[model samples]
Target chain A: MRALFLSLAATTILAGIAQAEPAIMPLDRATILAGSPFDFKIELDQVHAAADVAVTVNGQPYASVFGKPAEFVAEEKGKDGKVLGSALIARGLSIAKPGDYTVAVTAGTETKSVTWTVYGTPAVPTAKNVIFLLGDGLSVAHRTAARIMSKGMHDGKADGRLAMDDLDHMAFIGTSSTHSIATDSANTMSAYMTGHKSRVNALGVYADRTPSSLDDPKVETIAEALRRTTKKSVGIVSTAEIEDATPAAVVSHTRKRADKAEIVGMIYDVKPEVVLGGGSAYFLKSGIPGSKRKDDKDYISLFRDAGYTVATTATELKAADGSNSGKILGLFHTGNMDTKLDRSFLKTGTVDKFPDQPGLVDMTQTALDQLSKNPDGFFLMVEGASIDKMSHPMDWDRAVIETIEFDQAVGVAKDFARTHPDTLIVVAGDHTHGVSLIGTIDDDKPGTEMRDKVGVYDDAGYPNYTDADHDGYPDKIDVSRRLAIFSSNFPDYYETFRPKMDGPFEPAVKTETGDYVANEAYKDVPGAVLRVGNLPKSADTAVHAVDDVVLQATGPGSDEFKGYMEQSDVYRVLADAFALGAAQK
Target chain B: MPFALRRRQFLAALPALASLPRMARAEAPELTFDQLYGGYSALGLTFSDKVKLLDGQSVRIRGFMAPPLKAEAQFFVLTRVPMALCPFCSTDADWPDNIVVVYLEHRQTFVQPNRTIEVTGRLEHGSWVDPDTGFVSQLRLRDASFGLV
Candidate 1:
């Protein structure tokens, strides 16, 4: 029987050989849902006539299956005045059944073959009203610190609980990009939102070799899919500019995340029902005092023209709520919103100029009120962007407060979910950072030097922050005892064992030689110590960590998240929830 | 060097004070970030009278150093507040329009964000692309120098 089976397989391999070039879309070994639309392409290393290159799909001519002719482009440009190769491209194709698709393509001497696994979703829907929250780069250290600071630690146990402590489902998400083990916000969130691994800084498309960012072969995004299949409203809210990596991933498709002005246009193109966050600067016209655009593409007016209620202040945001405007475009700050530290306490950053900005909790509430109106439910993404922003500077206090603010937003989501059981809440971090809070810095138990105040292990004691008003945040950050947080990686910096009462911390400064050195402003702060850096001199702040990020969720599909999973898998669950692949007339 | 919000608020709120001509009152309506532009949009921005009238003349601006482009360059960007996370430092970094480029009279070392410095230079307006770096600046201070307050 074995000999007979071997003979049959050998015959099959022999019959598979053809004068054709192998074509792959939902490219080789891709796990596609029964009917997810993806572009199919095949490349020939050398310039070959279209008739000379033969293609077959599942042992038949590609024409017999796809029923369309593929456009052929020969002698694609190479750098330095030469042609790279020839290729074939076909957009908007999909296989409707669950099975292995073996694609074979052959040119004279060169040959290529690939396979893709097309899968189907369960017949029943799993979750509704998905609320996906991304804490840009939340890590274990940040979680531990938030628990200790907000809930307090007793002996070895946390005295209370974080908003995520009781989440019924959890997962350790691997955020590595398609090209490298390390990742950034764009590709990581792109994976979560599109179920396709992309190169760093690239979103909703493969990182093709071509120089043009928009010319890359594209994949359908969840935002596009949701729009195509459901009447459900989509909302994106973040402390970072809505055009920033994480939020933009929800609806953008560019190889570069820095194309914010274009991303704003893309967001306008999609017109997510409710949009709130900073980066009003990107929305403003080119000649406007605060606009960051190079052209006269006034997005605020465009959104308004499209019937979005525009608001620039917390008071205005609430007013827009009463507007029954149906769509809201809230531009809180001209840039990234100030972290909670600067927003509530220091009154630094852009908070002074853009005062009356709403907190994450407020933004979430406004979004829920507006989105819940539709009977079909909604999809919203909230980001505590400053968690990653402040953590990069090793400003743990600010990051923690931002996390607490994020938790408050989560609390609001959870409360909404309780009242509306149909809602699914997913709280996660896009990546992690290399920061930790080991113990405490006690000025009361210190010598003249700064390091002497560091109390690790047994010597570490409770922090002496005062929250007289009972708000989650401590009353004053400059307490005698405080969290001894530090970043594992850094550029040259001064370690000042105290809160930057004036503003957020500035750890490093550049020297005349153009290398980062410890910023000297804090050098005279009593016991400030200069600590040499470990990262490259070009690094102005600490960087994101490659470690797995912890994710927690609740609702029907939330159970699919367990142990460890790739960021891309998150999208599959989402597709199943919205029945994105279910045939639509 | 205390941060006086009241002073900044006073200067930013009342533009009527700006009517105090240089020849009349000892002080002028102190133009601020709030006064530089009145609206936000995608097409373009409108320059406040303070910035428009002060154009081509010497004026003072405060901001922190954007981590410099290089050590030998004669210019660097001066942004509102510290460039806590400088986007221009990286090739992928985005610049805010509110930025005021300072072309120094002489080369000087870049300072960290924590230090707030006062700069004095000729305020020039309109979009002008830099020949050296191709950096487009709508507002610039030619022949400028700064002092740590």
Candidate 2:
């Protein structure tokens, strides 16, 4: 035992400080934009004297390229005595050229090297206006089901058209993150907005070893680049809280997306010319009745002081336009805005409190009107956020209605693009969900069981939904025959045959063991059945799918988005269109 | 004469000691979760009349324990419904403002979320940032203990 202990101690010591070396900032295969600033840091495996370490870019010394010496720390402390070696940190560094740059570091046998493609765009701009519309977690089934539901299908061929069907360009975007295949909105949208693929929950920054949420190495956001490189205005509109992941991705850098208070501060720091959405909780001071902030920062007053015309209602939004207000800060609800079912039909959720919330179509049109006034043009991003929100609850009817609403918002953008031919309208989803419409659930079928009532193959008859208003949305959600939408991944949940009219479905509830189980609330629904979950019991809701989301675009720079591309490549098109890398002499 | 004086002093002390049992640790007024907030509005939630009346007093509330941020969390959130999703499940999920944090007096086994129980502790209100998690909550129950009812 003593002899074995001696060998074990030797082995433990070797592995102790011998874990994988810390990854440097602007990591391997990083594509840095020309003229844009980034933080540079090199972490070593073990402590080294300043004279012992050497870093070279393409066989040239690091100081020769950056023109500034890096500050070195001998020994850096990690979480609980996990000794990360010596480190060098340099803030706000840039390489303004279009070429392959190789970076190599040598710190006594612990050698690591990385390559970067610092690329620039053409000298001239490709588009004047950019309308980027993202449907959160949009899957192929939603589009196919929406086409069939909204427009009739006969002999495998029927339908007037969908708003996105006519787009001239298409791309299969790979939405994987730098860290994992499964990603959240922060990384995915950050890839789109910043031309960088960061780790999950990180936006516009490399996830670093630093404990400070704000101290991570940063990348320039598209909004910031546009502000720095051009005179164009910027706008952001989302159904989620303004500080939520996708909207916050326009301008934010944090290791965690839950830093909502800090995200609010970041938004104020950039101060996008026009901002509108829910989540007033962070804008109010801590003492305010509904404030979610712990700080005394009153963003509501701050935005007003910064020349924004704040509107709390749809009526006020309309009035603000007539009030000659060029910049509008619309806060329609405190949290995420109410879905269409609650806002128009059920009168539940938070609709009773925020009665005058504007629909996406109206919001899009109003935003276009305000943005068109900018002579230098504008870049507007409008998000249909709730498609994913309602889908998580397993509320199919509500989710489909929201899809229709989102499509209508697309229609609004298309209409504006028609008038403004110089505008580039790119409509796509940030990610795909596991949801699909397999068949119709016919109530008239002679069966007590819900699954027995499902119509398959040729027997799947057309659903009789009346569009008496001719406004596109069905008059009622509880028709005799309707689409049976199902998710590929979910926790233990009761499968109720009918739409949940009470509100969004709480599919799973936490048990004493900290594991999620089928919510007993729906146990009494007429044909409800408890479906044992295939996912881990810890999963409380349905998860996102790895399937590819369809992307379509039209206008000047849209021609570049062809075939398959990574989500990060979408940013390159955006940057090239705006000429973020063009020399601004 | 000295012995008689000492006897009189001892007799007076007996009455003072008798009143101590009645005067110490008096029972506090009861306040419920519904009574902690007056109104729910988009602008902000207002603390209830009962909350103002019983501020800094001992109060008791009955609710289910929502799943904690981590398995070893010292404080568990008391909620009206078993949170469908753990607020700490992901950065995406956030706790509702109505949540009451229960810092137990001693470690206790976490009960099923569907179960209801009563918590008694000193009522504390105002924004307090959790140093460990950076979770900012406006209302909390400090030095609390609870049991299944």
Candidate 3:
């Protein structure tokens, strides 16, 4: 398989080198959903007259195949009015047939040809609801640690299983984006939401050469598809800001995910029935103290006028669940919500300011209760956002504890699935972080040095954590013996083998030279040692790993996810489960 | 005399010089980062009474200097913690809520980022946008000068 992939990559590069043809959107061998709307575009290498250019599909004129005429521009100007090339665009085009389509474009001697495989699903649906739970940047080590920490371990094995461990079907998902092997949360989740792979930092659109983020080729997002073909309600829940990349991918189209202000307008455009998370900062006017917007448009008031109940805290969210309008918009924090370790266990990390933030479990339950009110069923997406946020800073304790909290949310979804067997629950991660638990760190076995206290293979024993209060979290994070996890890549930082009892860790900071350096705040800790970074000086923290993410699923239509699949392929299974191709109207 | 002893003797003579009634006295109030905000909510933050009272008055604050937005600029950001991202370089980097923008009184070389520095200036509180750079800040310190603490 490795050899085949490398050779195919080599052949594609050689073909591109051999031809000076126009670049096209949806590159060769693309698998498109039948009858799904997409923007078709072709970029010619040189300016050409509309009469001189010819486009064909399957030996027929493109106009005859798509039943529409393409808009042609003799010269496409780039940034600062520089002439890039000539272009042709056809918007809102869909192919209704299930077959291989060969699209060829020619202008004088410049020519390019690509093929797409259009697939159709069964006419009948296999599931009534689809719940996708994504733990951003989740990795195997996080799962292992969450299981060991929450469920406890004995005699090197038999503790118990996590909510995700017992899924009936599992697969290894390749999460590489279109442009590179490495991936971020934006494109990775975008591919899952829209069955098309895109470049990094892009969501629901192909990365184009244009400077304008909005002009990129657009694709139909899952939420838009549900609105188009079904009567089902849609809900988006996350611990991060709702306008963040993961949740925004459900109904957004921009080449850049950082276009967050624009993303708020996109969310308003769709106006899903339930939207819960942090990020009220973008909804406020500029005069408001916590407002992050440069404009004066108040989205909170806009949504309220649109008949949506807005909740700002846990108590308000619970109250708004009884809203007669059946639409709830909960903004718990101005930024990312505080984690469970801060809100429940430690009572640190901005908990004083926002004391009543809800946990992911409670938010998920609220979403389920409201979304299920619709008789036609619903499509819900929940995200455990801080699992990735804390991992980037190499805060292993916080990251692992966040994983535990995420698993508890998964348990809630599983409980709902048990009652509604027709519901499909898909649990996966957008990408993987390079983190792993090596062994135990036993304070009892140590001299003065913390490094000497690290217990390796034979000396490693089970961690001593208690759940005396019956809460899922360990009673205390400052255990005498604890798991030692580390990231493969990290910025310059001081390695302290203990939990940050104050707040989330800030391992590195930027210097005046624009390079990252180890923060000296932790330098005074008794056994802390400075570890030179393995990453570049420009990187502020650890980066995402290129390894494949593990995807697990249960309920109806899960058997289809059995082998290796691309991140985009996961969407095909989802569409098939709901029969999104058939017109329910 | 040793450099330390010489510096100590010079500092020791400052009180005697202050005894002269003709010299002006500095009355800069001290403030901490925790005292800047009274409450936080999703709607917005409320300024503490101390911050409102010290507005337009000379005050001293201690913090670490965040990386400046431009190589040659009139101001820098002072944060309770060292910043993780260069806001000028990364489009996605966000400033913390409690940052204090310090407009320098004169051109000075930037110091190492690992040490804490004390800044003295007139405190200004409001939502202000810098005209030249278009940088936005809720709190600011005007004509600020700093020294290593």
All candidates' lDDT scores?
0.79, 0.82, 0.88
What lDDT tens digits, residue by residue, belong to model 1 across residues B1-149? Answer: 45687556544543433333444222323345566665443234567778888887777777776767666666888877555445655534567658888898655555555677766677888776678776667788887666555
- List, for all models, the DockQ compared with the true complex: 0.18, 0.35, 0.54
lDDT by residue (tens digit), candidate 2, A454-559: 8887666777676778677778788898887788888998999798888788899887666898888788899999899988988888888777778899998999
Error of 2 at A567 (Å): 0.6
TM-score of each: 0.86, 0.88, 0.93
The TM-score between candidate 2 and the true structure equals 0.88
- lDDT string for model 3 (A1-585, tens) is 999999999999999888576978877777788888988889888889899899999999999999899899888888899988889988889998999999999997889999988989888889999999999999999999988888799987937788899988999999999989999988999999999899888999888776899888888899998998899999999999899899999999999888888999999999999999998888887767777787888999999999999999999999988777789999988888988888887888889889999989999999999999988889999999999989988888888888888888889999999999999999999999999999889989948889999887888788998878757678899899999888999999999998988888888988888789998989998799999999999999899999999999999999999889999999999999989889786
Give the docking tier of candidate 3: medium
What's the C-alpha lDDT at position B34 in model 1? 60
lDDT per residue as tens, model 3, B24-87: 2245778999999998888788899999999999888999898887888889999887787666
- Give model 1's TM-score versus the native structure: 0.86
Q: Would you list the rank order by TM-score, best first?
A: 3, 2, 1
Candidate 2 yields a Cα-based lDDT of: 0.82
Error of 1 at A244 (Å): 0.5
Candidate 3 collision pairs: none
